[model samples]
Target: MSKRINSPDTEADITLRTYLDIYPHVCFNMIAGAGSGKTTSLIKALSHIVQNHGAKLKMRGQHVACITYTEIAAREIWDDVGNSPLIDVSTIHSFLWKIIRPFQKDIKDWVIERVGEKIKEREERINRSGTRATTKEKLRKEINKLNRQANAVEKVPFFNYGTGSSYDNGILGHDDIIKMAVSYLNSSEVLRKIIGQKYPYIFVDESQDTFPEIVEALSLVRITNGDRFCLGFFGDPMQKIYPSGIGDLPGDREWKIIKKPENFRCSKEVLDVINNIRRTGDGLEQTQGNKTVGSARIFVLPLVDEQQRTEYLRKVQEKCVSISDDQLWLADGHVKILVLVHRMAAKRLKFPKLFAAMNDNAPLSFKNGLTDGSAWPLAFFLKFVLPLATTKLKGDNTMVMRMLRAHSPRLNKEQLKGTEVRQALEQLKVGLDMLVKQLGDGSQSTVLDVLNTLKNTDMVKLDERLIRYMEGNAEETDELEDDEEGKEALSMQNFFAVPAVEFWGYLKYYNNQSPFATQQGVKGAQFDRVITILDDDEGKHAQFSYDKYFGLKELSTDDSKNVKEGKDYVIPRTRRLFYVSCSRAKKHLVVIYYTADVEKAIMNIKRMKIFPEEQIFKVEDLN
Candidate 1:
């Protein structure tokens, strides 16, 4: 009674066929690069289950459980499987939470009992006298420390603090989701049965990004149900860009490894560049032939001082403007600009200008940041305060207070008033509270009034442009439509549209940490161009070790001695980092330095040999 579809003539089709032929409660790991039809393969496999196996077993259904790392990805899969009679897809977090929420008491009791014992030990350290530490302070420190340790150990890998109960429920974050899912699978027979009845085919998209806990959870589902459930994982090992993602996949024995390395997203020239960089090592060689080809180039800018930096950025801006205008007539072809920083200071200094044009637009379509970095306090104000000003309680003090509390949760109301950030926070909080109260009370005109007020402010004007630009984008509209089903499935707004204000505010105060602070934040993300600003300061270079550079092919070995010896041996880790940064760009790679030290830059090029001298661009020389 399930609908079936024929496999198209694509790599996904070939991969799915191999999966069907074996059909052994199977785990197939399909490695494919971005835009290389990995999702298509997943779809094909799900369709095959509907056609070949649906109705053969009583428990099995056509519903395909598709898991991804981020909400964005989950939405994408939902869109792909939209209204399909034969399939149902969701992010693993959303899926597990849905099943577990009904059993909240059970889960809460289990987690609290376990975590409570640890909390008690920490509480004991503080004297019973109300003198030692407050309950919130104690809880905050202990929870943050436990979460960090859990993430470090890979036991609890993904934890986001913002958004909702799923992230901030004190028991579940990204890593906790996996642990809880695995625990549920181990203990709950009825739950397993329900999941089995709902979904027989488990297709984990971006499997390379999945941690061991997730794998264990999926494995349990398969084991509990036996032949009724089939597990299919799709990802490219080479593209396992996150540090935690390295060597995460099960070996060939436990799972069938299917290689799908056709380069569908890039040009031949681009593929060549990737291959050339990848082939420099001994153990690492191109397995799947490069099927993608495109024009790839590296642009190196010599670092001088602040003056030179400004001039360099100006020139780059001009180039971007030119490209944007030109691309209006042609396909923009996924242009991304990656600005790599050796330190936090460089990132703060360089990123504002690089993204100024886009950020200035209405409905701000472009976002820039370090992988897993903290949200900017200023950005939060821009997003939340203006909207809030439109409400009945339109006092500047309330707006500032809300903004402060939202951005910095560690401070209490008393502390909020005393702190230097007090004035700003008060204004923002008052404005926001007014806006929310007015909106909730159905005061549309009041909301418009706040908007008018904000229109006069600098932040409000920027947000207005951002709003306008967002409304004008056809692609965003399409993506919004595609994500509608996923939004409904998650019973939330499109995750991306969940206002950066609320999201970042929740993260800052409740979560008290940035998800970007970890490795998982940057996974599956890229830029059309990249600018790496290396810190030549002492002790910083040590951070660029082989282990730190897992995204590049060169970091697979111990070559620290060669690098230290100054034998012109590029630090494999540094090279890999450079490679990862460069690869993030779909078109161009830009390197910016400020030391006037062309020696280091020259040495790097000679050692890595990633690009010729002609490809390097001197920013000072540019018109």
Candidate 2:
């Protein structure tokens, strides 16, 4: 159940209502902290528009555009609005794609040019490797394959780009779409005017996550028309976790500030803990006065002796288990143990890994696993595609068919039942093995080479739809234009040139059941209790550091220097990530840090009263 509720209008709510009533004439930036009812306020503003200004909007053929940061957010807005055509709710990517897809000819031309450039770059690399007979043969072989792949005279109608799993997606990668959208809006006045007229009132939720370029594009429309269009920027600067983020408010122009400091999620006690971490907190208030006061502590997990550290972690885990007892909170979900790390593959945490084992092989696994918490496409790839592709193992016909059926939307069940399809797959696997073998003994092979061999195979008739899988094309999203046969195949070909082993290794790395989740993945989610494991590990993105947030070090200077000069400066991203992790708990928040000078840092922090001494515990002390 949600901790927040629809109550009487607060000071922030009244201000938002007043500002939105005068929208298009008055631009406002709602600086809402975590769990400040930003979504509810957004919904309320839209509901207001639907009730009061619906007729005017309907007559003018315009709608209020609410652009969210994620698909989940978009859905929540949709559910709240309940099938209102006057309300345009979509993720920034979806909204931007809708605007840019119409100008797809330009995008198509751009993709072909990019592909051509890649081919040229590959050729140059091959040339530079060596002039040996083997090198020449390899180069010639690769060039011929490239020529065959690039043989089509016509344009690429649909190309897969973004990292998402929507099939044969339309032209332009998500980044490209944003860039192209910015370019198109800059050059085309009529289109911008049309868009401005279409969505005169624009509300951007979680505006901090939006790329500056994308924001500028939308801002351009509003700027060109001059107050004829209104854009409400709603987000918390403290929660700006993305590295590329430029903070929540619009950089293009100034606006009236509206602060929503009432945190409806966590209790005042929890807020106090969050506030202490960031000196700039807005002193947010809890929604319910009777809400339970959650415990917040910082545990210093010292890495004293290399061997003893393992035992220390075991004790720490056991203590965490006791702290996260199920009887303590009424929340239904399992306690989330958040491990802050530089990289999932680079840093090792045992708890989450222990539970990673699951047989994702059955036919219904992909579908069921989605509801049960596995990423659909990745799970499908791991269970079906990767296993079969890596080995010459047979009798996995259903897995191939299921994967092909999923990725290739046009492939019917009857198509999978065909004996020719099975024979082709069997032959394809054999051919793949031979290709890998030929590249033998210290020779490296690219993902593209493997995919290309499948594309060129002759044993079984290949469906153009299933060709993407054979080709290791992941970007073939659902937005791709259908061929004369009305079929689409989304491919991840951009990942093709990557070394096959490395690609598989990354997947193997991802195929884990660790209870620990990166702070970014679980930011919006709430847990009964959260155990955040912080460490200063090498290869971790320097942007997120616990030392800076814990008041052990300054947030600026070194981190800022590292970013600007590309030197060994502290990571600035850690600030927001730490802030986000601290705020994710509804009941208890435990921060465990492993630092180099742990004893000194702990002593300094305790002396400075950074955290309550009673709440702070040493790893050994817990035992």
Candidate 3:
């Protein structure tokens, strides 16, 4: 076991020390600010527990449950602390699946009932589409497939279709599992007791962003049995960016709330602007000090004429380039462009072109993105697996190759210098083309047939990561992930029966043409210099109004403010979105307003003294 962590630099660190000193008796909440050292603080807390009380907990058969917000966060914590049986670190889905998996019969029944309702509704819709010659055959096939799925539920009694699979695979789409777990715990007193006996400490990271149902269920467990375990919640209320935030989460007078209000990521200059805009920025200090001097600037662009708008765009591009060349910045400066809308990054900022330029000419290349640890696997499915599994005559080899080069560290341009690997990929491409012909149109071949054909070929390297992508870990595989899972013990026919369009939709989500990302996409990520573009012309901004935050407008007396005080808030999603974007920058932040009356808003903000005079700029000045 590691030694108890001992680093007390700030008041927050001291607060953490005080909480952990009491150990298993206190139910505490850590209220952190944006850019604060929450991750570091969490690591310290975990380390203290592991080094000091881990052995005792293990002796008692009670372990710590550290629940993170996402898989990436879980992996990060696991990497930092190293894997330990005394502690269980995982996302909410993974953690819940373990607790709920034992009650598969109850869950399966619940899932089947839900699926049956959906299938019935779909059948009605298909029938309503009319029996036209063009649509009749397709509708008939769909109905048959749904009927087959419905029938399979009885044969495969322990199945879950909610996770894009025939059974719960301990990965993806955990909403159903969470609901079922809540229901099961509410009904079964024995199961709750069993859980309480096993886990003595429950730590929820990013608790502000936790789902309402999950929070409610956890609170139910605590309230029902108050003396069971110590539950610790840690997150910033300002950072609650999701739809169902911790506003409805269970908390009362007994739970002690501690504040960690130090800005470790940003400088005082950046914090000044942030403090001015933030609703609860009292006593928030930048701990970075003289370490990193950061700058914040707001640019108001002209929208009167086409010529002025064109010039404004030109200046913005120049500034982006200049920011890249600036010495004070760190990392790839070009990667720092943030947009209000995903489309704005592609349309106004030309992010696709920027990425293409970077990949074509830069010293380094961008990596292929992943969503829920399934990017490369899905890409592999689309490229090699799908065509072989389905009756599709042709495959997009170019797109497949692009995904390969982007994501795989071993399959880059540098690695392609050798003729052997290049020839192998080319041979594999040829093998894929020929296999489509061998399978033929309407050929009755399973996914295993494709695997069998390519298993021994010289084109496929046994040691390559592609194998992992093609064949995921059997322990973690479900019906969608591994079609052959159905055939193993259930004796089900055509277990991997995903529709072509349905599969494509999953793949298309991660494989976007542009490099520009949304606020939600770039959370928990930091950049050297961030240039955020604000515009609502695409109609993607929804009901989020920037005018109120920018000081141009006030909260109308008639309008109901959703924001809650202290514990949680029901404020505009736009406020959280802006906070997320602004907090990402380490050294420099440039926010561009692309509205018609941009000058008025800028003047209003200046009058309010939200931004210093030197930090505000006009687009015309840049030109």
Question: Judged by TM-score, which candidate is best?
Answer: 2
Local error of candidate 2 at residue 402 (angstroms): 10
The residue-by-residue lDDT of candidate 2 on 438-515, one tens digit each, is 333443665556455544554223444346555444232222222111111222222333444443443533543444
Q: Which pairs, if any, clash in model 3?
A: 562-570
Task: Write candidate 1's Cα lDDT for 579-612 as tens digits.
Answer: 4444444444444443334555555655655555
Cα RMSDs of all predictions? 14.1, 9.4, 10.8
Which ranges in model 3 have alpha carbons more than 4 Å from their true place?
1-9, 21-24, 116-147, 160-172, 247-250, 280-290, 303-314, 317-335, 345-515, 551-571
Tell me the tens digit of each residue's lDDT in model 3 across 460-500: 43323334334543322223211222122121122222222
Better of 2 and 3 by TM-score: 2
> Which runs of model 1 end up more than 4 angstroms from their true locations?
1-8, 51-62, 123-176, 186-198, 280-294, 305-307, 316-335, 341-597, 617-623
TM-scores for all candidates: the values are 0.58, 0.70, 0.69
Candidate 3 Cα lDDT to native: 0.58
TM-score of 1: 0.58
- For model 2, what is the alpha-carbon lDDT of residue 512? 35
Question: Which number leads on lDDT?
Answer: 2
- Residue 204 of model 2: what lDDT? 90
